[model samples]
Target: MNKPVPPHAPLLEYYEAPAKRSDFVRNLFNRTAESYDGINAAFALGSGPWYRRRALRQAGLAPGARTLDVAIGTGLVAREAAAILGGTRDLVGLDLSEGMLAVARRQLGLTLVQARAEALPFADASFDFVSMGYALRHVADLSALFGEFRRVLRPGGRVLVLEIARPEGRLAHALLRGYMGAVVPALSRLSGRESATLMRYYWDTIEACVPPAEIIARLGEAGLAQVGCATELGMMRAYSARCPG
Candidate 1:
């Protein structure tokens, strides 16, 4: 039999208790870090790296730039950003889970910090790019997170937020939901309990997200310019914007 659903934490207080429901993610990733690439490939159908590449490319990094990957679960996006910047750039992977960072550190050999998205320890204007992959939906205020991203980015730098967007067309929406709610979880369950928990959490969170246009507006309010979005595979999207120079 399946486990009972845990009590829901208030959305506004998500950061206050990051581990209550999310510990599963951290512990799962930590234990399965070695097999993360394989797992993602199976679940994402080899499109995981493609999504990361698309998101990193949108950051438009100049050579030798510094970028921050917030909530960088296993440094997948950070590694791609490093490659996009030609390996001369600084890629900092930050997350609240030490277990996740442990895998990230070993896999990418990049700097990893255990920190929450709401309170990055870096100083103002510390990064040329700030990236978050599938992170915004779980947080409390999208606007607040954008504000933090803006604060850490240098003028002319950008924020790249890659997320599961609300599908555009009716047919596409139904198809994507079927994939996420049905196909993805069924495939993931074979990976075991941790995988099941992650799928459950992520599926629930993605379904609860605001539209891409709303996300663009929030980035604009956070002081980013040229805010834009690119959707792919119908459900996923990469939102990009620049700080005023």
Candidate 2:
């Protein structure tokens, strides 16, 4: 059953200046890409790898399915998808940062194009599955990006969006806020980074993010079907939906 589309809202409303936020994110990853994996493992309490694998598997991927991984930061999820797809056909990666792509190429040995999530460079219905991990919040327009995602997927193709969100229960949310607002930055600082401001920005962005139900609703409103969501580690969510055939 199809649901009504919610009122559209500006994606950058949470930030006073979207470009500055974008630059901060890009530069943060560029600077810390070398140690990102280690940092994430520590930060997520060693659950990062399991989360990544679970996200990829829940997308209903197969050995030879066409896959497009957007925001392929260091290609962690892409590499997993590639390994699952077994090098058969239709594997591509896209991102806005060349440095991230370089790191991804070195790590995953897959070619990735530099591109924006809202404006992908691909023909209509080009892929069987599209996946993104921890990147949707940076896009300035949710509707535009979802539209592009739907446009690029073939009939019955699925889109998987994995992102961090504030924990739902009041107590959990409070603890998450404190950890993200305080502990994360402190840890980043302890790691000897020049600036831990990026962690602060990350918390703000995730807190401002739309909830999982909203994401599934938006995907359906954008011409997708069979929308569903799965939450992991209480705060991370993977939403999936299929393009109507």
Candidate 3:
């Protein structure tokens, strides 16, 4: 069996055992759930919603497609998807955090399920498209997540994963590190210490995440074809692929 693709190396500062990762993440997100959207808007300079919608469109999300937004945090991506689908009737949002799901429930009229990305509760061939936004770095294993995405998708269904990647250019890397590492956390302090900690952890995960090539390869390994990645602003990546027909 191929080794699992962990999003990043474990941060010992947060938790001691790898098995404890889910608990740690759940607690952190629960603590920061209320302020998540505000912090994201401030960090993204208010471009998050527009960018998410455009990326979904670019990845071929269409009206009437049965879509599942995995790891859908606070409905940031799901809301945009609903707009494209003309309503929430064809959309479902799933996340591991109940607190995040609660916030998303209030914001979106779609079906919301509390679940992990690696183990979706739905039956096979349940969706035409699967999307995950920003929360790719939070999953325990990319292979399991992608496998579940493929299993839940009908033949020829598409998958789109949105993430923040470390830039290759020296200047771009430095600038992003400064803004995400220092500036965002500093601004998040207005919300609370947990929010600031979440932002800091967010940047750390981006910096430590596996490369895009690994992600693309793993998608292929998961039996998804036509895997490709589109980069925006040197830091944002939209990984797309399709289940074989």
Give the lDDT ranking, best first: 3, 2, 1
Better of 1 and 3 by TM-score: 3
Q: Which stretches of candidate 1 lie over 4 Å from their true place?
A: 1-35
Candidate 2, residue 156: Cα displacement in angstroms equals: 1.2
By TM-score rank, best first, the candidates go: 3, 2, 1
- Lowest summed lDDT over 10 consecutive residues: which window, candidate 2? 1-10
Writing each residue's lDDT as its tens digit, candidate 2 over 129-173 gives: 999887877776667778889999989888888888778899988
Clashing pairs in 1: none
Q: Which candidate do you rate higher for lDDT, 2 or 3?
A: 3
Q: Best lDDT goes to which candidate?
A: 3
Best model per TM-score: 3
- Shift of residue 52 alpha carbon in model 2, Å: 2.2
Model 3: ten consecutive residues of lowest lDDT: 40-49
Models 1 onward score TM values of: 0.84, 0.86, 0.97
Evaluate model 1: give its lDDT.
0.72
Candidate 2: residue pairs that collide: none
The per-prediction CA RMSD against the true structure, in angstroms, equals 6.1, 4.0, 1.2
How high is the CA lDDT of each candidate model?
A: 0.72, 0.75, 0.91
